[model samples]
Target chain A: MNPLLSSIFSTGFAFAILRVMTPLLFPALGVAVSELAGSVNIALEGIMLISAFFGVIVSAFTGSLFLALIAGLAAGILMGALLAYFHLKMKADIILGAIALNMFAAGMTIFLLFLFTGDKGSTSSLQSLVFPEIDIPLLKSIPVIGEIFSGHNVLTYVSLLAVPFFYVLMFKTPLGLRIRAVGQNPHAAESVGINVDRIKLYALMLSGMFGAFGGLYLSMGYVSWFSRDMTAGRGFIAIAAATLGGNMPVGILLSSLLFGFVNSIAIYIASLNVPSELIQMIPYLVTLIALAVFAIRAQRKRDKVGEVLEHFDPEAVKAVVKDVIETEGDI
Target chain B: MEKFILKYFTLIRTLIAILVGIIISVVLIYIISDMPAYSVRQFLLGPLLSRGRFANVIENASPMIFCGVAIAIAFQAKQFNIGAEGALFLSAAVGTAFAVSTGMPTVLHIILVLLVAGATGAIWGFIPGILKAKWGASELVASLMMNYIAYFGGLYIINSHFRDKDAGFLVSLRLPETAWLPQFMPGTRLHLGIFLAFIFAFLGYYFLYHTTSGYEIRTTGNNQKFARFSGINVVKVVILAQVLSGMIAGIGGMTEIMGIHRRFNWQMSPGYGWDGVIVAIIGRNHPILIIFAAFFLSYLRVGGQILNLMADVPSELVLVIQSVIIILITAEAFLSTWKNKITIKEAERVEVANESVAQ
Candidate 1:
């Protein structure tokens, strides 16, 4: 197994990790925006599912991959706005709204599959355009890093490029400030006439655009065709990445890479005659472990902060308790 | 009776939203697919044309009753135990394994499966509850993330351990006859689970609204600090709510498997855990109301399937309609003009009071 592992790295397993991570990286970036905006997009699964469906269908119909990408983006925008409308203006619970959208996407896509191709579960027969790999001849000639980075879809490059760009947009811009402000304290932002709702809406729309791009990568870029449940929890993994990264762009990138690495190894191990089902479960198992660990760490920090506050201002705690009781009577 | 009418106003709003949402969904379908014979009315009435389809609706709603009441219990305690999905799957897999492998009398077999399923689900739910209570983990994230772990982990077990060699599909071996639940409607698929659903609905109502423990759970949900001050262990209450919710969801899995499928199929549920969320909302977290909410949703699902079979329309339109209904119902401003009148009355009172005080 150790020899196999060493040979596996030499045999391009590391590069495979990057290629696998590319799909996850894009949506994780989108998830970062949504979570940072304080509206967790649980519909990422559905968005990616529908986008992958439409991306391949539209491309197959129009015979143009670019058009398919546009259609994918449009679908993502629609889902994002739908979720945002429900969560932001409608005051619907975020997770509930997301679950509805996800369910809708799942069932609708299957229904549409039956309507369009007369297939119950997949759309593999469509004449869709597959993305062309980028030819960085010089980069390809270079050593390990070049092998890892070169020869991918244009969308993959864009997803990678988004990491730094998103960092700048999230931290360095006025719009970013407004979004963070809304997430942290919408009341304060509203007091300052920040149009907090509008900021959240915009953030959600942008998140949709990125999520759709991730979907496009899955359909036209990776598989060249769409299958039912094609995204297969990649959207959820993106969400896990975003949260694990603490909703930071760079952190999301790193988290996506970690997930990608685990997924690639799982695939490799499954292919090597290890039980495929157990191997397939590895990524999800690892995600649960990672989430539990992260939750514990965060909980510890919160408890420590509470302890410090209690020691510093015992009277404030009593005041809070009194205020809570008063509020209780009103409810 | 007048108070009843007032209490039922929200129910009326729900009906109107359903109508509007169906209308919009039909319009979207007609525009996209160019079919007019397949209208919203067909979607509303298609399933009721036959007894078999009617039974299907009840069979579907049976699980909704369990999970919906489970969610209602958690909502009472203000614990969002979204892990019901995970709990349901774990129970189904474990219960099926036990049923298929065990050799026992019919009655004992059934009881054992239900008990084991409930306890397993409770353990699954308890993890997140304790995590939230002891470590302050966000129950929402913990529960939701745990769903995937449960799903994939269950898949691993199914593929390796429970794979039925003689069974044609990727499903478990059929349970013994002793483990099977008795059907209620003989020819129809409806089983004794419907009776269980009724019992659960009443039990949930009594447990949440009548019992002292129920009051504590609700009080904790309403105000944690206040509940703590009132000598209630808020943490214990939240954890108990999760356990109760999980047990109810576990029974749902047991009923679904033993009564309907007879085999453990992983994709048996089309996201019923999430649908339970909508039912809880429309029910206003009331147990009695859950029966109606679950029935309404199940009707839409069964009716939509019939409509799709009879007409050229896609069954997915029903889902779009359901999402719209949820959105419309949850919106603050979607209430009728009666709400506007109440707001205006409050405003006028404030204005007149100010005027009198000024003098």
Candidate 2:
């Protein structure tokens, strides 16, 4: 077997995919939440930057990981509240407001970075703490599964746990129902005494929380330093992930895993004779193709529904319409 | 006077937003800078103090004008196709291949390079446009993904085929003299691209406001369902808007390369496409207004550079100010009460005038 092929086939490669997918999963989950609320938080990019920056700064100065985590989460939630004020209260365009926040985060982080550390690129000089890795003793006893799942960073396990947590939160809770109702129809939600603005605010804040975790993982677990624009395009790619997943918990997990697999492959192939730039293009190109396929399928589904409607029996349609009007009148 | 104020309410609100943005920057400087007063002075006065510095403003604003108009055009048609960044990068690389390898008459060479650049950009725009039009894929995400693909793809082409090994950097061979845009001033890099930028802006204004297709684009943008009901082809209009936007962005890239760099050497996305968004927002998505917005943004950028060099302040401060202005100006309710008051006053005056005429 070829060396490259052998390397790819190992349990280590599966572990690499899981490791790479953690950050993406967090933000993609965030995107799904906010997108479900009908106010997409494109500023996950900025929120992640702020959280990552504050986490490093607080941890480095105070020497307390807990304090750093609090500070990071607080910063992200505050950004979400600011966006809510701008969009819901001030009637600003959500997209433009989010774009502004992204620019602010990109600028203010670098500006404060220089002010604190005298470095414009990264905080490599600071001795930031990394989150500890956990080994599942029972899982470690297994052969292939143990190698792939044991001794991973604590956040990676948390990310996996988050999927089920997200499913419960989105499906089983009253707040979740209200959020979905608000997303489906704001006027109807409002009429039922569900404060649309409040629900949206909650949704955005929840998104910020999830995005903050991703940022913390990037700065603390993935590497031991805070870097300028370190999120790169992962924040944007998460939007693609969320959309490709149809904004569902299980779907988001699968899509994020897919992206992680492609990204890890891109990383592995860099050692080959192929130009690294072309290899770098693969993940993004895959996203474009995936998006197109998703859109086409969705379109076909809609057309099929239209076809069904067109072919409906007139007598059955009339009976259903009359039944709905009678039921409304009785109400 | 009340009527005048009411008519220009949006303009007034925008001016106020800009003022607030400047004040925010000043406060930030005072808090952050050791020598606050000096930093503020350099930021406000540095660009206007020197002839050469002012030229930098013009040189910077030229490409911004092109991009601003491009953004304004696409935005007018309500297509959030941010692929201008990708189109600019990819087209510049393709244009450079022509600029470096081909030997032709100066005028013909320039035209050929620009046309190829525009066509390349159009293709970039067409992808997202058609996707959104046909299948409802979000143009915003599609275009953004395209930017990275273009960046890496362009880099691959440049690194593998066009890399000048002796240049000591990852750059293409120097552009030939035939390709350079004519410079207006001997000392300044201010080139004919500035005039071309102005021409393009005017043409964009004409195409968007005067032509039948422009009407269709605007009508579709204003209300897609209504436009469709009125017999307009919303799909075609959307695709056309993206393609035209990409073409304009492509030409802008060509101008930047032809006007400034001696060789094709952009290691990272230069971010002019993003700046064009700010320009379009500030200009309120109007072609003519975008020129002034470009000049204003370029002035601030130049000032930031000077402040960085002289006062030791990071120029990223300008980005903070730009974002604040964008958020405030786009907020519909920001100055709504004041606008309403002005409109009420104008209505009262009109009623009084009518009563007096009847008497």
lDDT tens digits, residues B141-246, model 2? 8998899888998888787888899988899887889988878798889888899999999999999999999999889888999999999988999999999999
Separate DockQ for every predicted complex: 0.39, 0.68
Looking at candidate 2 chain B, the ten consecutive residues that score lowest on lDDT are B1-10
Q: Candidate 2: lDDT of A321?
A: 51
Kindly list the per-residue Cα lDDT of model 2 for residues A168-251, writing each as its tens digit.
998799988888888878899999999999999999999999999999999999888999999987888899788778788998
Report the Cα lDDT for candidate 1.
0.80
In model 2, which runs have C-alpha deviations exceeding 4 angstroms?
A10-13, A125-127, A141-144, A191-193, A307-331, B353-359
Model 1, range B155-254, lDDT digits (tens) per residue?
A: 6667668878787778988889999998877888888887888898899999988999899999999999999999998888889999889888887888
What's each prediction's TM-score? 0.86, 0.93
Which prediction has the highest DockQ against the true structure?
A: 2
Q: What is the CAPRI rating of model 1's predicted complex?
A: acceptable
Residue lDDT tens for model 1, A88-163: 7667777777877887787788777877897766778778887788967888888887777788777778888999
Residue B227's C-alpha lDDT in candidate 1?
A: 96
**Clash number for each model:** 0, 0
